[model samples]
Target: MSIQIGQALPDLDVDVVEDGAPARRMSTASLLGQGRVVLFAVPGAFTPTCSDHHLPGYVQHFEAFRELGVGVVGMAVNDVYVMQAWAAVQQVPPGMKLLADGNGGFARALGLEFDGTAYGMGLRARRFALYAEDGVVRQLHVEAPGEFRVSTAEAVLQALKAPEAGTTG
Candidate 1:
């Protein structure tokens, strides 16, 4: 039931952080609309894998994404404050955005929310990344439970660069 290729992103309001503060609430359509975008979501901010590898990969390859005229965004179910702190700690680049999907509304809308209550983490977004152009998904890479591979920055970059790249699960 998750979103798929050729589907426009669902319109859901989520918090945005800019300049080390909560900037404003923005709908998913407006945030990922208008151009090429790469949006990657993590289960939580400051979590081990998220902080150590997932987010850092994006930060390191941010310029490469920008070079391709693709906007990179990081998202998590945590609040804006935690996102801001994570951004600060990760030293997120200027053109990259970090979103606070508080309440997991956006993730639920995408059918990508998972029950992390077993881990005492509550509702959270699955680790995944998608490439979209003009609001329609072109490629989607969703990681398996307790795994991280297809959603990494390098994987997405390779997909984007591939001539035959298309919708993927």
Candidate 2:
């Protein structure tokens, strides 16, 4: 079973890049505990889809997310070094962060880890995007193994456009 919309994000320590530098250890709770948050995970780093589209979408729409009062973070099953390289290559701003799930602990805890031995990547995260209020997921978009749909930034934007009424911060 995969992580559902109402689930609290797993508490684990993962690598985080906060200032366009190399990633350092950070608690997942600390990462998601700051108000509203949008977290997108890719299957791998430097891959075609992840490189060309997945991450860039989040990067470009960052301000729009902020307007909705959400902090954005990106993750993948790779290590911190690759995340740093990808961020630098894509010119990702500070508003959006990239994290490394080095051993796939977070992904495994969420039941979102994938076996990609055929592709030479061992365990990896499925393509997904989620919105969390505080630390509980309000929306989760898990994609098909080789497809992208509900996980795109556009989908997130649309979701944030009409949040529930009477929901307090």
Candidate 3:
């Protein structure tokens, strides 16, 4: 089942690229516990939509997301090495974390995993963006296949400004 809105995030242990070359495990609690955060998931690290638009949209709006008091992160089912390479190739923005779900461990935990073997891509994450505060899901925007509307940086920024939205940090 898909993760429901208002549920606390599942236990997710993902690998994150640190500095420029090294990677380390990061827990969901550690990443989302201290503040409002935006975690956007893509199918793969270097796929056309992901590389051309999905990831870049977040990177380009990193400053704006931060200005609204949100920590922005990109999550994919790719390994850390591929994630890091894709980030570099895209000219990753400073302060944005490009996190790898590795074996889709985190994505599976969140019930967001999908088999892409028909396309020969193996396991992958569904496209979605989640907003959390203190680890509880505050808002979730999931996209239909081949659609890219709700997870854009602009949409997230507008949501953050919603009078009735946001989680107390």
Give the whole-model CA lDDT for all candidates, comma-separated.
Answer: 0.90, 0.84, 0.82
Off by over 4 Å in 1: none
lDDT of 3 by residue, 4-42 (tens): 767888876778864465777878778766688998999
Local error of candidate 3 at residue 72 (angstroms): 0.6
TM-score-best of 2 and 3: 2
* Off by more than 4 A, model 3: 18-21, 163-169
Backbone collisions counted per model: 0, 0, 0
| Per-residue lDDT of candidate 2, residues 1-169 (tens digit) | 8777777888988899867765678898998966999889999889999999988898898898888788999999988888888888988888688888989999999888899988899999989888898899888778876888778888778867765411211
Q: What CA RMSD would candidate 1 show? A: 1.1
Model 3 global lDDT (CA atoms, 0 to 1): 0.82
Highest TM-score against the true fold, candidate: 1
Q: By the TM-score metric, which is better: model 1 or model 3? A: 1
Which candidate, 2 or 3, would have the higher lDDT against the true structure? 2
* Model 3, C-alpha of 149: deviation from truth (Å): 0.9
TM-score versus the correct structure, for each prediction: 0.96, 0.93, 0.91
Write down the lDDT that model 1 would get.
Answer: 0.90
Which sequence of candidate numbers ranks them by lDDT, best first? 1, 2, 3
